[model samples]
Target: MLKHAPSSAWFRSALPVLVAWFSLSAGACGLYSLPPLEEQKARILSDQITLRALTAQAFLEAWGEPTYSHSEPMQFFPVASGNYIPRFRVPLGESPPGWDDSIVSEQALFLGYADRGELLGFLEKRLIYREHLPAEQIHAIAAQWKREELFKTRLEAPPARPPSP
Candidate 1:
């Protein structure tokens, strides 16, 4: 014959409920992380990535195709177009060419880089935020980038033609 300790009896009774609660909580929090785009860019720059060597195929293999792909007319040089200027987390200086200059110092985070349909490099400028971004938030930011690009594309026009040369 065996006797249960009072505490042991209590723990046994509570174990299932606690386990269930923990399982639900963990699932609710989600189990995914997005790579920190800013940090990755820094690493690439620090490594002195040879942009010319990178190709669209290799880039796609590494990072996966961007959630969105689009181009914008070069504001300073209107004759130039067809470059795949990827969307960014933070807009670079004078980007969108006439937007307010506030927060222009924070460098843009390019999700992809290609020109004339060839990958030259990805990511445009350095980050202002030096702190380590939580990995989990990266997915969210990536999703946000997709959303922003889709919205912009739907709402904006193709780069305007240079005034009839």
Candidate 2:
């Protein structure tokens, strides 16, 4: 007696099940796993060289839009002044007589990403500093942002009219 081979229809039905089983097993083996968000954030932050090189646009693409942003004005004296004097002063005859001790204002942008527990500072569109806060601090910052947003909305809303009699 001759044994009959499995029909094409049988193979077709089994193919999907086989594929799903393999997919699930691969996932269970961690082959498809991704690092935790916190770990990823830590890794990204640890790369200071890359972080410092990132421009504001690149940072926005990598970290997404910040929850809140603010501009800070920074002032600095370009020339030596006060108690801090230069050890070797420039020859008075060689250079201009008076020192140009003008206060220069720099525009810095502070981006706060509460969800990622990060605060990034950018000067002239270039990243200057980054801070990663703990979960508790992140939560507090998120709460403060929410409160500020609510207050801003309330202030911007039109005054309520008295109900008609």
RMSD of each: 19.4, 22.4
lDDT of 2 by residue, 1-165 (tens): 759988999999999999999985664233553444454445456653233345566556557788767653544222322111121123333432343554335655667777787766655564545657765665665566457556756555546899999
Instruction: Give the number of the best model, judged by TM-score.
Output: 2
lDDT of 2 at 25: 63
In model 2, the runs with Cα more than 4 Å from the true position are 1-51, 75-105, 135-165
In angstroms, the error of model 2 at 88 is: 33
lDDT of 2: 0.54
Of candidate 2, the 10-residue stretch with the lowest lDDT total is 80-89
Clashing pairs in 2: none
lDDT for residue 100 in candidate 1, whole number 0-100 = 35
The alpha-carbon root-mean-square deviation between model 2 and the true structure, to one decimal in Å, is 22.4
Could you give candidate 1's per-residue lDDT for residues 121-153 as a string of tens digits?
222222111112444444565466557566665
Would you list the clashing residue pairs of candidate 1? Answer: 34-139
TM-score of candidate 1 on Cα atoms, chains taken together? 0.26
Best by lDDT: 2
